[model samples]
Target: MPMVDTGDVRLHVQRMGPRDGHPAVGTVLLVHGLLTDSLASYYFTVAPAFAAAGLDVVMYDLRGHGRSGRPPTGYTLDDAVDDLAALLDRLAVTGPVHLVGNSYGGTVAFGYAARHPERAASVSLIESEPATAAWAAKLDGILRRVQRELAYNETDALAWITVNRGHNTARLARGAARLARETTLVRDIPASSVLTEDGMRAVGCPVLGLYGGDSDLAALVPWLEASLPDCRTVVVPGHEHSVLVEAAGTVGGHVLALIEGSGGRGPGRVSIPGGGGGRASGAAGPAVR
Candidate 1:
């Protein structure tokens, strides 16, 4: 277990380089979603594939999640963005790097791009959106519900989750309950500052949005394409919010295309199947070698 003390909080970090002593084509930083998510999501899914494809991969547990230091405060989006910047600085990776974020992690990645546009090579948002007013409100409602149902009604909630979502999910839910009860994460996140339209438009790097066709978030594709300077989106068919985990191949393919298109060196051709209103055929194209 590797950890980096970022002055603000100690973040649990994981890094993987290209196989067989090959130089990395580029660097990729993977950020996971809030609560029930950690670097494990990408580690078990896309991280290895990216590394095998000759990209350096970096993943970390955010503050108050996984094995990272949880201060019971500083759970704002800015804190997350700052942590990323600091982590990269400490790791001595100063060049612009590709960023792949899941759910709330995408929001943080978007925030990082907006804040430090020069350092972001590209951003791939998997079932995520920017930290806008609407996003904040949505998070507020969700957090409140979690605090009420998971924290306030712990025993019943765990029992229900164990029966419905299985013991693994129930165990994760138990940790979430402790986080919500012991930390200010539920409040700090909603109160974090949101980005304005101008702020969003300032991020000039290439952006990729991957959403499930059946997810309500698919509705944002049009807005994302319209808002970002260089934005492309894909709606994966027959999936929902958990698309990254459920459809890692599709997600990995699209993300690899974005990374290659952004200037990483690779032999294969990059082709994205869906954009805007189009739906992906569920083929993730050729596997990266």
Candidate 2:
């Protein structure tokens, strides 16, 4: 429940690993997807692997998304990017960082790294799409559904979520539903980010794009992996938008590979454990999808 004042806003953030770890090599920042918080959405899986691999982990709720302050306005992705820069500045942990982002979080990471190329040591993106023309209509469709669910105090919305996302716990489903209707500060942030694709070409660091082989968004993998000069991607089979949890080991391997590649420590070979792989050309070579 630690809150840091990022000058413009107070952000709710959490950390893992030893306090004594050096910021340069051990710090990682985990950015959660659209409607969830740092703890509930990201910490359960991604953070631990980094911590176990001798790195410190940091995560914060985007404004209005989790335990962070729900501002009356300012939910744009640029706002989120500013929030991230503000937090990093506040912590003073200035080093090329290892960034892991999921869904909209991935776009946020992409935006930040593109805007501030010097701050990234490496990056990992899961179930994420580059800011492209393909995203506008897709976002409209998601927002329309989200708005429709909110029109009735979220009863129908909750039901729709339950039927569609039945794999999540009841508490998580309800919590997400409640956040949808009650939190307004972070709404439209993801949709707004879809309006730009110029930023997509700005990324120049080692990056891994993650998606479920079965997910609808998986189709965008080729465009992104090939476009970025130093980027590649992996797709987990039999999973969808929820690739992080559905395929933790495979996802974990990719995260590890990205970190290793960033540090110039490739393992000589990467094994998928139980999923398929995609090939891309870059300094790091092809990795497990």
Candidate 3:
């Protein structure tokens, strides 16, 4: 584990290279979701697989999460994107790299791709969407509810989560509560400037979106495909927002397919079946659910 000072925030980063002293095929940056999520998600799930596939893997804890430096302010989406850029500069990863992001991290990855399209080889979003006014409103509602239930009613909330979601989830929720109560994360994220449809369409890199068939976000697949120029989406059946962890193999396989497909030429709509034991359908073709 190494900590890199990005001038503004110190990010905790982890890197995994191809095994057997082989040269990496390319680089893949993994970004985890907000609160209760860190590089550990990818470390425990897809990071090793990506590395084993001969790709350089980079994972980092976002500011105010995991082992990263948590400032009281500056938790906007823009701030997170800046942190990614600064981290890449510090690590000297100059070439175009595949970007894989989960949840809020997906939003950050999309923003980075939008801002630096030349450096983005491709983007894979798992259960995520681009930042928009609707996204902001959704986040505002979720954060407010978290503040009310978890922060304001801490003991009861933790107790309920422990009973329902298990002790580990309760522990994570505790940290999330502290983050919401102590920092400006809840406020800044909702207030972050959103991207217009034009802005999203401007990103020329190949984009891949993976969504859980049962997840509400699956509905956004059509919009994403329609919005991005060279975008493809997969809907993994019988899962929800936690599909990244629940079906790591499926997610990683789709991402790797996108990375490999985008290597020489532009990626077209292709359906790759049976990578991590789960079946996936292309959202562009038919509705999975």
lDDT of each: 0.82, 0.67, 0.83
Q: Model 3, range 1-289, lDDT digits (tens) per residue?
A: 5999999989999999998899999999999887777788888778887888899999999999888998999999999999999999999999998999998999999999998999999999999999999999999987776677775678876655344221266667787777888999989999998999889987898898889888888888878878899988888887788887777777777787788884323323322222244435555544643
**TM-score versus the correct structure, for each prediction:** 0.88, 0.81, 0.90
Per-residue lDDT for 1-289 in model 1, tens only? 9999999899999999997898999999999998777888888777877888899999999998889998989999998999999999999998999999999999999999999999999999999999999999999988887777785677876554344221267667777677888999999999999999999998999998888877788888878878889887777888788787777777887788788884322213222222122224532212100
How many pairs collide in each candidate, listed in order?
A: 0, 4, 0
RMSD of each: 6.0, 4.7, 3.9
- Runs with alpha carbons beyond 4 Å of true place in candidate 2: 18-24, 162-187, 190-198, 262-289
Give Cα distance to truth, residue 188, candidate 1, Å: 0.2
On a 0 to 100 scale, what is the lDDT of residue 67 in model 2?
Answer: 78
The candidate 3 region of ten consecutive residues with least summed lDDT is 266-275
Say which prediction, candidate 2 or candidate 3, comes out ahead on lDDT: 3
State residue 190's C-alpha deviation in candidate 3, in Å: 0.4
Question: Who wins the lDDT comparison?
Answer: 3
Query: Over the stretch 111-202, how does candidate 2's per-residue lDDT look in tens digits?
Result: 78878988987778887765565665666677568668667657666666654542444555566665666655325554555434456566
Rank list by TM-score = 3, 1, 2
Q: Give candidate 3 regions above 4 Å deviation.
A: 159-167, 262-278, 285-289
